[model samples]
Target: MFRPAASIAGLITPSPYTQFARAAYCHGTNTWSCEEACAANSDFRVYVTGGDDSDTPDFFVGYWPTGNAAIVAHEGTDPLQLLSLNSAIQAHTGFLGAHSRSAGVVLSAVQKVISEHNVTEVITVGHSLGMLHTIAGC
Candidate 1:
C-alpha cells in the first residue's frame, strides 16, 4: 500500500512495521476492508492485492513515503490454504507455494517500487505462517 508522502504517520512504540502485517487480518478484512483498520498508515496506496482461495497466496504491497520504504504485507495461513500447505508437507514434496506465488510477483513489485520511487528501504512483514513465502526471493 503506497501512501503519499504528506500523509500523517503514527507513533509506533512497538516494532515500527507491526501494523502493516496486521492490516490484512483486520477485523473487517472478510469484506476486504483495511484502510481504516490501518488508519495509522491510512495514507498507504494499495499497489497490488492478490489471493483468497486455497491455491493462492494472500498479500498486499504498498509504499510508505513517510518511511521512505516499500511495504509488503501478507496474511497468515488462511484456513483453506493452511490445509493445502499441510498436505504438501505431509506428502514430502516440500513445495510451499512460494514458487508459484512470490518469486516473480514479489520481486517485480519490490523492484518497481524501488526503482520508481528510489525508496531508501524495503521492508517485508507478515505473520509466521506467511513469512515463509518471503524467502521465495532467495
Candidate 2:
C-alpha cells in the first residue's frame, strides 16, 4: 500500500525516463546498475527504487538515451543527483523491509546533488506504489 502527497504534482512531469531501466549481468545475476547508466549517459542519467509495495520507483531525473530528454522524478529523494547510493536508500520511507528508508534518504541526497550540480530542471516518475513514493518526496 502506498499513498502519494499532492506536492508531487509540482515536482516533475511524466516522461519516457519513467520506464528506463539500466541493468547488467554479472556473476550469473541481473543487476540494475545506476553507475553504469550514469557513466553511459551522464547528462540524462538517474536512479530508481522500489515503492511501498512490489512496484519499484522508476526515475528521479534525466531520461535514458532512448527516451526523451526530460527529467522524470523531481522529488527530494532523487537518485540521479546523489553521490552515495547507500545514503539515498536510507532516506526513503513508506515501505517495508530494506527499502523503507530509501525515499527519505534519496530525497535528501538528491537535494544536495541539485545544489552541488546546479540542476535547475528535473522530472519525477513512478508506477503503482512507486508513484506514491515519488509524490511524497516532492
Candidate 3:
C-alpha cells in the first residue's frame, strides 16, 4: 500500500521544495495538501490520484520516481472525473462503483509511468476521498 506523505515522517520534511511539490500536485487548488515522500527509497516509482463521485472537478494525480524520489502532482475539475463516477454509479450501488472507477484511472496513469520509466514496483497514496484513487494506483 502507498502511504500519504502526511502520514509518514522524514518522507516529507518541512521545506520549500516540499511546498512546491505539493502546489504542483494540487494544481493550485486549496482543497488538497501535498508533502515530500521517499519515492526513490524503493526500487519502483509510484503514482497516485484522487476523485469524488459527486463532483467532476476534484480529481488529482501524482507521480513519484524511485530513482530521484521526485513528486509530481496534477489535478483538475473536469468531465473525465464525472464520467468515471457516472460509470461507477450505473454499475453498482453506493459509492463502491464510483471508487472503483476513480481507482481505475489512477491505475491507468501508474501503468503509463511504469512503462515509460521501466518501474518495477508501484506504491499509491490517497487520503479521505482519495482513498479510492490510491487503491486504484496499486
**C-alpha lDDT of candidate 2 relative to the true structure:** 0.40
Instruction: Flag clash pairs in model 3.
Output: 25-73, 40-66, 57-77
Off by over 4 Å in 3: 1-25, 29-53, 66-92, 136-138
Candidate of highest TM-score = 1
Worst 10 residues of 3 by lDDT: 35-44
User: lDDT: which is higher, 1 or 3?
Assistant: 1
Reference-based lDDT, each prediction: 0.63, 0.40, 0.41
In terms of lDDT, the best-performing candidate is 1
Q: How well does candidate 3 match the true structure, expressed as C-alpha RMSD?
A: 9.3
lDDT rank, highest first?
1, 3, 2
Q: Tens-digit lDDT track for model 1 on 19-130?
A: 7777756544333366645776765666676765345557777777778888877666656534454443562133366436655676787888888889988887777655
lDDT of 2 by residue, 1-138 (tens): 222444766246422333232221111111334554334444454443323322333334333334333334422234454477464465334344323456565666456556655665444444444456555545
Ranked candidates (TM-score, high to low): 1, 3, 2
Tens digits of per-residue lDDT for model 3 on 1-112?
3334665565756333334333433432333332233231223233544544253213444334433332323322333445554443552243455555555665567567
* Candidate 1 global CA lDDT score: 0.63
